[model samples]
Target: MKKPAVLLAVLSFIILSGFTPQTGIKPCYLSLKKAGDLKAGTADRLLADADKTRMLVTEAGEVPITVTEGYRIIYNNKKKAPFVNLIVELSKPENYEQDKKNVLANLSYLNAQTTGMETTGKLLELDYNGYKAYGLSRAGISEGETLGTFVIFPGDNMIIYIYFNNIEPAKGHFKNAAEYQGYRNDFIGQYTAHLAKCK
Candidate 1:
């Protein structure tokens, strides 16, 4: 289908639904970007080729899901150390808050995957972009630091996962809990504002 037609259908669905963001402003619907426009890594050296970024839109667990559009940003010139990756995945789900327990469990699985790290603080919960989310902080037992923020955007039917970790094994350090929280707030705020402008 053409972009405009898909967009029209999406917008109609959202506007007609009773769900609304916390601000009570409904976002004009649009894809994150056409796949061709995405560029990863520094201009000097390419890390991820835009043409290779592929996510199939399909049904999962009886929910009709489609990955309308999305993008990925990879930091550190593709090196695994001190890694950071920001990904935006916009999808349309059959129902809001569907299989919420399973969703949370998936996030918990990621938390368990971290190795050689000690919990630095309690799990941080948030009401981000009209959705319930949480974050976790951990420090390396003998090397690096890490912070992971998981956001489930119910209104938008999107899940944004941010993982920030120190690349330097011996020199890595995670700032205070407040600093991580600030980062989360800023990201969610900017994304919500941008969505409001979509059309």
Candidate 2:
């Protein structure tokens, strides 16, 4: 299947029953550009791409989920492909709390959805600035290239997903697991700090 299809399949599993229609004032999209050494794409372009992706996923008929409110931003380096991608999905406050409590269960469900093309590493439990978080490292099964780390955490009424991919490993961002962990941690800290200012 295509990359979007594959991504939708995985996201379908992660968000199938996790989001509910929320009423009242919607959260505003964060105005963030530079986080650590990463720079983001234009807000309009990122939002348009996210909307297109959502429409495609909804029309695919593979999943019965609809992302009513969210934002997707691609953080790039000098490379063409994004080095890190951020997805902020809003949910009801109650659902957010529940999801936070059941993060492990959710991660297990996500792990089961991984296909033969991808191999997932051990789940890394994290305390992201006092917010409960989890990280899963994934790579291609054949090439063994570092795909990225999927770092998940809960916000007030939203779920934050940070996909940290070192597309330009030749630039010496990270060479091994330990180095990757350090790099991801630094990025997460900087990114979350930016998020703290978001309303």
Candidate 3:
């Protein structure tokens, strides 16, 4: 199969197995009730907003590259809310080691992708419900900066990226850096635990 075709297949598997709405089965990602203080937004709305800002090539010839947004949880569900976005991307290489290296490279590329934002702090290795994952931090250069924690888990032929960000910290939802970190960890733990149960 072509690379795009393979990617589509893997993405289809992920969506059907985890994100799709089905009778009696809860989704693997975070939900409105599970988020507690955070409010929920539809993935379709998030994708639409993203489409306005960036062009996403969904198809190439006969094959389609599916970009699935799992759960979009935010503070107050406002237009400009502190949010957590979950997205899955296809791994370029078939080999696990090469794919892992590519994931790290992609994380580094984030620093240069945006003019005012930079990926900062050390990349930490983590265990998410028995799956190996990596987490990195990001910050905006300007004042009233955005603080974010990005985590990725490499799967069979896909990588799951979860980004947690606070766009406006002065609102005082999180008292300190440690409080924000705790919330991020709890959110990740809940998500991974749900996935494990589904499996």
Candidate 4:
């Protein structure tokens, strides 16, 4: 129930997990913010996650999928190898009604032309703190060489949006993805394990 306890639990999870990130280092934190931020308390809920992940038709023949994931690593297949670590995916179809409708429609149209690309319907998912997350992406789309990715943190007090390439594009500081597992565990999955919620 306490933040410290939660922080410990998250650290334990990361360390105990069999698979280690590339860095071989584990993060330790109950929430995204540090102790000071937790004690201060901040506003919660900015743009509430979409009520639903549905279908919408887009102008182009391409159908874009919308979804979320806990501690997910989106990699582009075309590049050299590991692809890029997506921080914040802009134009994530943030529009509520419009985005939902367009995403659904695009899915159908794309399905007809491509195979193995059907919306499996919540294929990979994670729901925590009344917040449900899904992930959306395609294989061939190019991510360019991210060579970028520093810190992927939360905005406001509600969401953790990862944003890289702040000053430059395609070229930015690199944040070892392996080091963030601890932060992911505590922040994501089930409940607010580390940070103290507003009283």
- For candidate 2, the 10 contiguous residues with the lowest summed lDDT are 52-61
Give the Cα lDDT of each candidate.
0.45, 0.55, 0.51, 0.33
The list of candidate 2 runs beyond 4 A from truth reads 1-29, 44-66, 98-104, 112-122, 138-146, 149-153, 166-172, 197-199
Residue pairs with backbone atoms closer than 3 Å in model 3 (clashes): none
lDDT of 3 at 132: 57
Q: What residue runs in model 3 are displaced by over 4 Å at the alpha carbon?
A: 1-33, 45-80, 91-99, 108-122, 138-146, 154-156, 170-172
Which pairs of residues clash in candidate 1, taking residues 3 or more apart in a chain or in different chains? 81-167, 82-167
| Poorly placed runs, candidate 1 (over 4 Å) | 1-69, 74-84, 112-123, 128-131, 139-146, 169-185, 192-199
Could you estimate the TM-score for every candidate? Answer: 0.44, 0.58, 0.54, 0.26
What's the lDDT for candidate 1? 0.45
Query: What is the Cα-based TM-score of model 1?
Result: 0.44
Model with the higher lDDT, candidate 2 or 3: 2
Error of 4 at 129 (Å): 1.2
Q: After best superposition, candidate 2 residue 56: deviation in angstroms? A: 16
TM-score of 2: 0.58
True-structure RMSD for candidate 2: 14.9
Stretches of model 4 off by over 4 angstroms after superposition: 1-95, 103-123, 137-186, 190-199
Which lDDT tens digits does candidate 3 get at residues 1-199?
Answer: 9999999999999888997643311344434345556665554223433421122221121222233222344444234465566654433233435544555555555444434343343355567787655655543313434455455553434556677656554554565556766666766676677677765
